[model samples]
Target chain A: MPPETPQPQATVRDVTQILTRTRGLVDPVLRRAVQQLHPHIGEMAGFALGWRELDGTSRVGQNGKGLRPAIVLLAARASGARPEAAVDGAVAIELVHTFSLVHDDIMDGDERRRHRDTVWKAYGVGPAVLTGDTLLALAMDTLAQAGTPQAAAALRRLSSTLLELVRGQAEDVAFESRPWSCPDAVTVEEYQAMAAGKTGALLACAAAVGALLGGGSPSATAAMSRLGRHLGLAFQAVDDLLGIWGDPEVTGKPVFSDLRSGKKTLPIVAALASGGDGASRLASLLGARPDDVTLRRAAGLVRELGGLAYTRERAELHLHEALRLLEAPELERTAAGELAALARFVVDRAH
Target chain B: MPPETPQPQATVRDVTQILTRTRGLVDPVLRRAVQQLHPHIGEMAGFALGWRELDGTSRVGQNGKGLRPAIVLLAARASGARPEAAVDGAVAIELVHTFSLVHDDIMDGDERRRHRDTVWKAYGVGPAVLTGDTLLALAMDTLAQAGTPQAAAALRRLSSTLLELVRGQAEDVAFESRPWSCPDAVTVEEYQAMAAGKTGALLACAAAVGALLGGGSPSATAAMSRLGRHLGLAFQAVDDLLGIWGDPEVTGKPVFSDLRSGKKTLPIVAALASGGDGASRLASLLGARPDDVTLRRAAGLVRELGGLAYTRERAELHLHEALRLLEAPELERTAAGELAALARFVVDRAH
Candidate 1:
């Protein structure tokens, strides 16, 4: 039997309904993108379809929420940019994300993703590698067809964003082979740098491209970029929380998989720095081949050390900053409200 | 030991000497590109020095012979288009070729290139991959800054060429894993398709982009593209010949490396289809484990099966056709002769 999808919104208040509504607004744009991508991508049909076909049901369920693209649209709308002009840029970033995920799965030897066989596991390494490359090429291709003279600048933004993305992935991979005291004991500064490189760069790109293509004012684009960057930080913090504490049904991975893999998520970092006997024990147990029981024990130790509380506080601080940034400049009230609501949704929700 | 710097004009026969002479005219424009690319390229500092840091040999080399770029330049010049106007397009395609070589070496698991360790082997996979990606991005960046409005159209040519390169790689990888037999012999038709996808696509792109960027007539660009396609085919056939028969010291690879890898290069395919005892022996030897001795034996059998003779005839035929295409609609006499000279150089080289 298939695992149940997590309903993190059920126990959450206010933000649940806001997220759902915003998602509704974003759905049409995504549908049109997939539609356009499906037909006009004929020359690359074999390679393009090969990537799309690598999933069994992984792509069907528990795929990453379309958060980055939504951020692009919301930020674009807030900055008085049109939604249509921003959608392709949104699509391009999403494709980059998907491509990165495919390669990361291979590098990590990950077998399952989003509740199904990962691309590398299903299609073999060479094809999976090529699929990632094809997605990247197609991302450039889509950005080029951005329907305006401003498309060139938008593509430049996308290209720089990709360079940053590769840099982030390199850091992450390099970290994996190095020594670690505990799964979550990474320095806060290091954590922030990784988040900014891996997550914030693309989010900033999404907003910048959208605004550029939508004929937005330079100041407005800068404002949106600021908002997007903060949102990306908050989003990653929320994701790190889900990796450690969220239910397996919702996340579509074995609960505490990050601990098993020795990932140093935010909470663990805070807990490790606030050291005690438990911290020592946590350090020893990490990279020690944790089973389910060990993972539960580790979680208990993290909570006892105040890691959980510290992470939550940091996330809340960032969410507040994001909200403040969103309100700093001239924007349509409704668009600003939507962004504020999305920011709240990111922090408060479980998955 | 470092390889000696090959002189630009010394290596060229009659066919390519004129191309070497034109190099003097294009040096200033090419240098401008090298300057522009330097600021954006981070870790490619050694490469920027162009054989300087490697083994401390600062002597000038052929500067990649400028074959592909010159096609772009001369084709543009032949059609009443100024050489100055075609430089960026020329530089862009050459950059793209160098970038392709970097990535293809990684994909092919090659240890040595340009008489040195391949980028991935020398610098580690992450940096090498980034270098290739950076160069690809830089190509697009350079193309976008073209001094003409037709830059967009030229970029489409490069992007489309990239798609073809990926397709060819996919096909090559897939073909390698399939069962080996004369039944699986790639027909001349399939060979043409593969060559078109791999070699011909970029050559045609070089000529097409040059014409478009240089303000040549549409008919001229189309004719040049046709000529380039045939020239590329002839070039590959010669390369296949060298793969089997070239001196290892000159080629910088093991002699008959293609046979050991079971790469059904053109001559081998032609030999397998002839269906004689020698062909049978060659196929059986290939299907068995290939040591140095077995590969040498297989090479002898392939020769006896008329593979080398057939490939030579086929290459000469394509070279003749390229010359014919160059003469059609009558390009200016001097330019047409230069192109014919290039075709002969491409098909008749010993290495």
Candidate 2:
């Protein structure tokens, strides 16, 4: 018989507790790694991580939510591996995540992140690129120092995943330059592939590396990898949903920011693929530079065409797939319980 | 007694033969690694490596000289390790070299390299950045697959070297924006440090990784690493000298390119630090943007102030130190002979 679904109410509380506890363990490890970078670039890295201001003032409580590293730890624990054994893997994954963020901000011309000036804005583009490069190198160094027999395999997995992440980033950039109204504009499958590379691949590597470092069997680690991939898709789907519909206060972005920038996110891709009057109207509203009024109208049209509902359903489906993958027999029951809870938290989180 | 310095006549011939033979082996390994990247990015990578044109035409005879990988293999052999066993490490170093080239082209806004359009110019900046990142990830992956017990150590050394390279690059960028006439402007010592990080660190890592992967003892690897560093310093010093005095036809750069661009290379730093009338005149000739006439005058003043001779002396000193390091007892006599020859070649090469 299929495993029973996790209780939504209990899962919510458990996920919050689990993330808080995991973040407490992982953040210090990340800080230490960043500190080990060469002093000048380390300062830029510290700023990128929100550990310091551009003027070199120390700061706190402004970092990312530590979602990727938390996934690594949870996946490791769920595979019956010791959480401590996977600390390096967790830190490595987080570093890679931040590296991507720094580069992505530059590529997208994003001025702010976490309500602070992006690295490229604070320091010039050259330093910002070097900062990202430094973090990536440091991440590999951290993984190598894990001193586990599985370290080679972990490095291999992470490196390959990093390449996939770059592929996704390349495709995303290419897509942005393409004419959105063209008949051959990015299709749903192509969009999914890009998302998988950009988001799913790194998340998958995080889980897989965690499992390997934790001493999980190969088959078990593979399952964790799959679980992470689906979870990433779900996470990205929700992120796309919120990009248009999320409250500005919560997201720390302007109203309809994605629409204003003409981002071809999952929800927008789905709306464009809906094939009806609303899709045509939405297409008309987007251009080289869409004004606020048109962006508002496009958002309304996307909603009117059931794009919001479709995206929400897509996120749920992926979350279900991730949870189902967590049912592998190799996973410890308690850790699996936490995994399910984390999966729920991913899609359910408002931000 | 100190080992007899090979006659300059014999050394030049031996160095040519060694490099030509080593390149035949190393180039194939590098090509295979680049081919193994995801096809889309592999194309960009191939273009960056000068293996193919932007239109996907298979190009030939346009790649780098494979100096770094040759050092890797020769260092491996010098430590009494089989050169074949260190192929992956050699390829990894070469990949890192190309990664730096790709990114540095973007940072410097260099439109052409090897008499062809740079990756950033041929593709967009975003793709160029991703292309560099992809090569870096692939390099780490290649190292991890070496399957040697020392793979972890190799990964750590290479990652650290990569970070140092970025630090050097960051400093180079910062130094460019600083006024050359400032009292605290880049000193000779600071220039050397930047050169060590930018060029010496990677070459050192190449030799160290080669030694480790080739199963050499710790002392042998350390000696080879030191040799590589001094050799790199010699190489960069020569390159800086060429940036001003070398023929444009040979260097693939414009006449008085470094001086025209107001680059703070080693010779420029030396001329500035001369602390006299010639230095002042040279300083007056340089500005935020120098014209052809001023750049020509500045180059003449720099030479008149002994900057060219001073830089050439620095290159020879480093080359001497590199050969002295080759006296390590762990190094095989025949291989050390080849290495010494290579050291002489580095400083003596015209372009």
Give model 2's DockQ, 2 decimals: 0.55
Error of 2 at A83 (Å): 2.8
What is the iRMS for every candidate structure?
Answer: 5.0, 1.9
lDDT of 1: 0.69
Colliding residue pairs in candidate 1: A6-A250, A183-A264, A184-A264, A184-A269
Query: What is candidate 2's CA lDDT for residue A246?
Result: 83
Q: Give me the displacement of residue A150 in model 2, in angstroms.
A: 3.0
Best of the candidates, lDDT: 2
Off by over 4 Å in 2: A1-16, A179-183, A276-278, A287-289, A328-330, B1-17, B38-40, B177-183, B327-330
Q: By summed lDDT, which 10 consecutive residues of candidate 1 chain A come out lowest?
A: A38-47
Q: What does candidate 1's lDDT look like per residue over B233-272, in tens digits?
A: 7888888888889777767777897887678788888888
The lowest-lDDT stretch of 10 consecutive residues in candidate 2 chain B is: B284-293
Residue A207 Cα positional deviation in candidate 2, in Å, after optimal superposition: 1.7
Top DockQ prediction, candidate number: 2
- For candidate 1, the docking band is incorrect
Error of 1 at A56 (Å): 6.7
